[model samples]
Target: MKNESDIISLRLLDQTDVVDDFMEWSLDENVSNFFTRGTFLTKKDAKRYITKFIVTHPWFRAICLNGKPIGYICVSPDVGSDRFKGEIGYVLSSKYWGKGIATKAVKMVAATIFVEWPHLVRLEGMVNIDNIRSQRVLEKAGFTREGVLRKYYIFKRKLSDLVMFSLLSTDQLT
Candidate 1:
């Protein structure tokens, strides 16, 4: 575990130990709903996703706290239409919610993207309407809500609106 007080260490996702922890965390319903609509209902499903999302995609990373894989965040270039845009998403274990971990992790990722991937002109997220806590995290990390995407997503077997948000590298300015 890397002990950096106040801020959790963010690193590229790899290693069997972190994968084992991620598999367990992925099955938790509370953690699944906020980011991906509870689509990963079992450990096996999560492993398959981790294999493709984490293993194949070199840009994703495990969000670690005290040497434990508590959640994950990923950034990737937007394919087609908007080649200059990038998308980012994150999810944390239910136990870590309300503790500002997500916000911190997001800021770190944003900083990394702005610095390392300078060509990424826009970074965005589509958040479920009912996810107030997540909205707060995005705001705290400097994302501004752009608009409501009505019936943009289906979660838990029902249609739901999504809040679209983005942060530009220039947003750090006044």
Candidate 2:
């Protein structure tokens, strides 16, 4: 994995990945407000999510700062047309927002994906139109604003339009 900074690392996840802050952020409506999906109903639900699902994804990783998980980053390895293209998503505790944690993590993971998965050429990020902060994160991570996807998702009881951003292996951002 590419280390974004001395304090940040993208580390593999496991079943025992449960953390108190993770559970707390999962239940915080305000914290999850702009997420693409999910607001775990209970602490156990959040824990189960991390253990059973989060740890199983091929491209998922914990966003660690100083050895503590503050968020998660992942690419939907099975969603796109082929293994060469993937959609990415991430979630971080609100306390860490506005600090560039997500931006740095996105860049680090994107770099790793292009290098670690030799066949991969494109990485895409979809941000809810209302989620400007996340859009900025993608922009700062060397992704280009391709176009907007209308009525892209029905997540969390809200149907939303999204902006699509993409990064290609040929682009020189690093």
Candidate 3:
């Protein structure tokens, strides 16, 4: 959990309290645009979806501003032999677009995760090739574009590419 400003804080999600916000975002096509799945139509489905993540995700938090949820961020253990790494993902309501909230949340999550797990040396994030805004957010938070992943994901039955970005523990803030 982190609070960089009086207006914004990241807290472990409370399922009961965040259901509406989660549902609201999950149902919006624009908000879940790049997600291959998760075009839920009802609150029940949204809860079921979020509940699964809450259980499996190593770190999941609600991005709140003025006590209202505006987004979410999470980090899960990475695959392969690299125990010192994690994969990060996030989503922000379109209403909060252009507010720099995503960047702050990323910085907070990255810093807190590094401190919480001293062994972690890298954090990775993948953005759909067309999400220039998201790519900028990662770059602003010190993640470097590693390369393109060709035909990396199947979103809405269409093969799409992604831009992989990574931030190293040794990476200094830009």
Top TM-score hit: 3
What are the per-residue Cα lDDT tens digits for candidate 3 across 43-112?
6776777678675677888898877887789887876747788889988888777788899899988777
For candidate 3, what is the lDDT?
0.82
Candidate 2 local lDDT, 58-138, one digit each (tens):
778888888788788898864546677888899888777888889999999877788887787888898888889899999
Clashes of 2: 0
Model 2 spans with C-alpha error above 4 angstroms: 1-6, 78-80
Clashing pairs in 2: none
For residues 100-149, what per-residue lDDT tens digits would candidate 1 score against the true structure?
88888888988878778777789997888889888888998999999999
TM-score for every candidate vs. truth?
0.85, 0.88, 0.90
Worst 10 residues of 3 by lDDT: 1-10
User: Which 10-residue window in model 1 sums to the lowest lDDT?
Assistant: 1-10
Q: Between candidates 2 and 3, name the one with more favorable TM-score.
A: 3
| TM-score: model 2 vs. ground truth | 0.88
Winning model by lDDT: 3
lDDT of model 3 at position 69: 83
